[model samples]
Target: MFPAEQTLQLRALDPEDNRIETSAGIFVVEGSAFDEGLEAVAIDSWGTSSCALDAYSAGDVADLGDGETFTLNADGTYIWQGDDDQISGRAQRFFFTATIPPDFTLSNYDQVLLDEKNSEGMAKAFFNTLTVVIPATIILILIAAFAAYALAWMKFPGRALLVATVVGLLVVPLQLALIPLLTFHVGAMELLTSVMGTVDEDSKLTSVNWFGNWFGMSEGEKIAGKGYFGAWLAHTGFGLPLAIYLLRHYMVGLPRDIIENASVDGATEFQIFTKIILPLSFPALASFAIFQFLWTWNDLLVALVFLIDSSGNTTVMTKQIVELLGTRGGDWEILATSAFVSIAVPLLVFFMMQKYLVRGLLAGSVK
Candidate 1:
């Protein structure tokens, strides 16, 4: 089978067949009629060549001979299968001086992305991650920009303490916040549901199901549940420290004279911030946006704790890949395909926004 089209031949060995010889391995064909149709078996190994023994069972292979050559046991045992009990004793042992040919196929990727049976397909997880990441990043940027601007320019009691507290929160490991935040989310939801429960049918609050409608809930859908809203808030809390720190530092560097001049020209603080500071601070915002986007996109722990519900509807890419590891760990092809799909979006995002990232970091660090 080395040439793929070659016919198998069986021939009587020379009288010297009893002698121990060095040659490309041996083939022992065991069907009762195997010897009738086969002629002399000659393995041509004289030339420098590489081949694979595609027929070797796990332990059948013993050793590799010198370069471009191999050896096999010249003696072979043939079992005659006379009964159903003998089926397990039958095997064809073939040793060939060959190497495994490389096989490349796109079927792995096709299965991972296109096959719905493949753990509900990665497409669902891709969208779930995007849903969690985009809103979380946007919310964090909007909230953090306000907080950072206020910290940079606004004066008030305990301002230094607030900045220090935000900076201090950055050092706190996210692991510590996991359980407490989850409890808080669950408790808060329970409280909201309880409050809504007390409202009568005729109450103005219940007239339009404002809470449910605000959360985009469908008919009979409860407001207390795992979804994008909670995940967005969780990520915002985790990301705010760094976001505020970076934007606050960057905004602080803007020329004070411009702010003073704008104030002198009858521009309100809100107008100056909207018209001047926000545009000027874009590099910082974009930088944090990329960071938060990538972080939230690749996140697994937070999603697992906050977003993934009991019904498994909201799994993200990281969790999806982990599930692949658990279920198809032996399937390397599937694993590779899933992993590649999971990382592709982040890689695309990073490359596309790399300029802003570099500019943002350098801009903050330098001035």
Candidate 2:
């Protein structure tokens, strides 16, 4: 249905086999006749210099008698002549519509399935992130709440030093601990496997080959330095300190009067935390969830160092998008669609939790 036009003066033709050759000039064809099945076509100027159209099918260049009236089988056009027209010496251009075949199926089913599978992979990545985030959030909130309560109230010795140590650790860069942590993880995994008698004395369990036989993954598809468990543990460890610190700050700000009243009611510290503090800390919890979810969802470096394999079974959305760029970079539509797919889940999580992030949730409970 797409319409187009091309206009050029008649030029000389060069006899180069069966293909019609055009001179170094421009030609324009404006007609309702455009067929996609046509084969080879060429345009030439009055001089012997000629050029052939870039696109030519086998059936397009069939002999149409004396060559003055040749039939174009396709809707798409090609430019035979270069920028300079030999006859006119002016800029030359060729334009034609891309003909869609009557029987040609526009819908590519295989491509659709490929797209669906990619989407499924993205969903899996989101699920994996959630697996990491939810447990980490709950643990962090509980520990931070207890620490904050103790630092603010419980009259414990060395409270200031403990709080100071937590605050100091916040400034420590995570990158510094990468090597030591990886080594520890490898050693710990091996130690556990040995104690469980999972490996024989002759069959040593190297970190690189650990997941190979266990998960039945090929060498290229292996998570060489760190396995899935290692990545999960790494995420937990890296997230724990900051989580405890921030949550402690928020929980420490709670009013002391509530705690005292709960105590007067014969409530234990655990009872107060379970019944009162947790419900009151929803806003802070939600805020931290947003941060952690966003960080973990978009994380490529951590996933790359820990999760990806050569066969791409463990590969996450970020790595898949990068690989897509290398393979399908020219396809703008696919690239945009895939990028949006990667971000969709994180956006949904943020919107879902935004209501709990209201500032006044803790107002009445606190001073």
4, model 1: CA deviation in Å? 23
Give candidate 2's whole-model lDDT.
0.55
What is the alpha-carbon RMSD of candidate 1 to the true structure?
11.1
Candidates' lDDT values, in order? 0.67, 0.55
Predicted structure with the largest TM-score when compared to the true one: 1
TM-score of predicted model 1? 0.69
What stretches of model 1 exceed 4 Å from their correct place? 1-101, 198-221, 326-328, 364-367
Backbone collisions counted per model: 9, 26
Clashing pairs in 1: 9-40, 10-39, 10-40, 11-39, 11-40, 51-98, 51-99, 52-98, 52-99
* Position 213, candidate 1: lDDT: 58
User: In candidate 1, what are the lDDT values of residues 72-165, reduced to their tens digit?
Assistant: 3223222211222212232323332222234577887877767677647477888888899989999999999999989999889999999999
